[model samples]
Target: MERDFKMTAITMAGLEEVLADELRKLGAQNVKEGIRNVSFKGDKGFMYKANIALRTAIRVLKPIKTSKVFDEEDLYEAIQRIKWERYLDVEGTFAIGAVVNSKNFTTNSHYISLKSKDAIADYFMHKYKKRPNVDLKYPDVKIHIHIHKEWLTISLDSSGDSLHKRGYRSATNIAPINEVLAAGLVMLSGYKGDENFIDPMCGSGTILIEAAMIANNIPANINRKHFAFENWKDYDEDLYFVIQDALLKKITSSHFKIMGFDKAPSAIKKAQQNIINANLEEFIGVHHVNFFNSKKEVFGKTTILFNPPYGERLNINVEEFYRKIGDTLKHNYENSTAWLITSDIQALKYVGLRTSKRVPLKNADLDCRFVKYELYEGSKKMKKQIDIGE
Candidate 1:
């Protein structure tokens, strides 16, 4: 029988609760949310499932040890005491990544990573007269060291290359949003594929693909080629296959319409190719139509979610672009809820529409707000009255 152990799922700042809910659904015990991460308890099989199924998590980590240390010597000694031989072999390649938030350490995360690497290498050298080589790109055993004040926690990265690389995007436009963030945006909008979904400014079709997966109960990493747990010393190939098959069997067909629209012909082509790569071409349709010129074409309730340009990566008139978005949503997209994420706080005033909800989020280094606007089937006067009532 597999013994239960604690694990952590790292995510963006605002999606911690969403990740915790996902873990609980997957039968995780002692689920707790923290800053940019969620901690839970599960066995080995559950760890594999989390890697494959979690959409909002960037990576899943299995902590091996935690210790209190004051200086670099203490850090090195603590790392050396962990039985590295169990997780890694003398002939295997390994890498260490560090995150430091301590006033005691004057060095940065890169230097801390280097120091931890030396300690691991020395431990192997002293025991067997030879040490393993370091492979930063594809390590056999990827380790993580995180320091918060005087407490340091060491973990084994179970999901390598980050879970955001879903392996479906062979083509992307400039400043493409991360896959995890795309999924989180879809989930946050409360769209479960029961209603029509549209990405007005879909770039590379990321949101469209993620929405199709959610609607059809598809596993997040079904198309991913590899995971770090497969390289572990005690990896069970048969068990991994069994878990994967179980998740695959849970997939269901979705009939709701999922579509993407982009004014750029290049963006439309990239989105179409990526949709094909994800095997979701049958479920999603991409068109070269500017959203401002298009109206809600699908019937029944619909959800429109997009990551528009905030004048950060793409060149655009921030004020005018946002104002057009408000005009289009109010005049064209009737009986639909529109949600957009942007970093320009001042530009939001030009939108001219009262937001129903606003969520604080971070897009890479920039602080963003994911705001929602509800569009009812009415005239401009009625809409103004509705806004005034709110």
Candidate 2:
């Protein structure tokens, strides 16, 4: 059995707890949540499972070294001191991604990455008289350099190309939500394939696809072609397949309806194509209908989630658009719950519905709110009476 080691899963803001829960459910040890990440201990097989199954994780990083550095020279020296020959070969290629937030260094992340790269190259040149090449697009070794205040952590990027690139989205709209974010939102809403799922303003069908996957208990990255760990010298191909097969066997079919809607014919077409790419055409349906004019089409309890335009990427009347959203939900939709994320705070007030829950989240670079509203079959008082009678 491989020895357990510490690993960190990075996620967006407001999703640390969600990611931590995911790690714990996967049988991680000493799970802990941080600001935008979760740390835990797991073996090599567990690491592979995490990369393949975590829906809310952006990337999984394995920290190899930690030190306190005061300047760029210290950073470079500290990186060079590590035995690079263990992780990369003299003839192979490598890449460095850095994030610096320190008062001691006035330089930016780009310069820090360059300095780290030079240090690694020089280390190889000194030992073997030749250095490895740097390939940004595809590299044998991908390193992550994080500097906060005086603390520095050097880690290996195990999940390559970010877990958000689930390899199923070949077609995308102008402002498609990140796959991780979409999955996170669906998980946060507490939908587990038992209830009908709908994305009223579904763009490219991301939320719809993620919802269907969750309902079916499908592994998040089952469709992904490769991971950075596959390039590692210690990678166990047989063990990876074993873990993958276990996850595949856990998948269960969901009968509840999962649907998406868009006013644009082009968006509906792209969404259908992407759904087919995911091999989920039988589970999800995309329709070309304006959300403002549509009503609840499925029976029983329904969960409606969407990433509406916030007047950030698309041109629209922000206040009136939000008002119409509230209006449609209040008058048309019944026996359902709705959740929408928007960066427009002032416009949210125009929705005119009392929110049951509000969460702060970040979409791309914009600060946003994920608000939930419950639409009853009749009045709240009448619904309460019905519940009391039951």
Candidate 3:
């Protein structure tokens, strides 16, 4: 636990590079981006910091073993060879989740999980005359199995439940964005708290909360209830607290405004409550006004990032709504940069303004795009001065 070890951070499909950047900033070594995951080398203290600090990561996995498996028996034998006692005990509880991406394995992933669990149980039974019980909901040890075409990896879920459940948001809207996705969008939009930020269609204030956290340098999971590593046999309470204190001490004041606007009164209320819950009321504000009817309140340069109705969430005229968005940004929100994420790509054509950047992203099961529209000052000639990559 004192030495450097390999760790993998799982993220959204399009956030691998973002997660890698975050890991590198946190002093992780040998950071590499893979498909929906980032692999890095860090000691146990870095592991603790990554769990609490990474904004784009979903879960940090500490791989205990990796091997090539031909069949179910190979998987079981490989898992059994591990010294499970190091991570779990007879009186403790454990759970396993299997992810299978293989043509050779036709069995259900749940069946694979059961087989792996059985292997561990048999190993402990033969060795110590007792076995750990399965506690699916609140397990002391959580194991994740990944089988990518016969290559098997067993990892311990250090960040219990996803890190998306950052514990500050006690309320949620009907179509609220995932917390990790919200934070990732803000990070990808390149807003570093240097300028004023806004979420015109903020549903439950997730983007606003995440933006405030980013600006203030707050640990992403500071409010999280628990992490699997807390219950590990080698858990270091003092080290974890030291890391937390260091991260907390790094928080700096944000001078710029972070605001959100929603047409619905309920959404505004929920957003306010969530902002207050995150202790970010000083930095964020929620308003119950339709974004289309309102002008940019902030005088200086503004960074607007929002997830408007994609015609799927909340009924709206997709074409007309996108048109209005384009009009509002082009006319009222001058000298600003606006970014929006939507699954309705075809509807994007209604927004007449040319997007400077179009990033392909995935939100849950829907294929989405995170697009950026530059709102230049003055006449149309300003568009020529702006660059695509700028």
TM-score for all models, in order of appearance: 0.96, 0.98, 0.97
Candidate rank order under TM-score? 2, 3, 1
**True lDDT of residue 283, candidate 1:** 96
Of the pair 2 and 3, which is ahead by TM-score? Answer: 2
Q: Per-residue lDDT for 1-390 in model 2, tens only?
A: 679999999999999988999999999999999878999999999999999999999999999999999998999999999999999999999999999989999999999999999999999999999999999999998999999999999999999799999989999998899999999999999999999999999989999999999999999999999999999999999999999999999999999999999999999999999899899999999999999999987889999999998755758887888899999999888989999998888888999888999999999888999999999998899999998995
* Model 2 worst lDDT run, 10 consecutive residues: 310-319
Q: Which stretches of candidate 3 lie over 4 Å from their true place?
A: 383-390
Candidate number with greatest TM-score: 2
Model 2 bad stretches (over 4 Å): none
| lDDT for each residue of candidate 1 in 114-212, tens digit (9 for 90 to 100) | 999999999999999999999999999999999999999999999989999999999998889989999999999999989999999998999999999
Q: Residue 264 error for model 3, in Å?
A: 0.7
lDDT, candidate 3, 183-244, per-residue tens: 99999999999999999999889999999999999989988889999999999999999999
lDDT-based ranking: 2, 1, 3
TM-score, cand. 2: 0.98
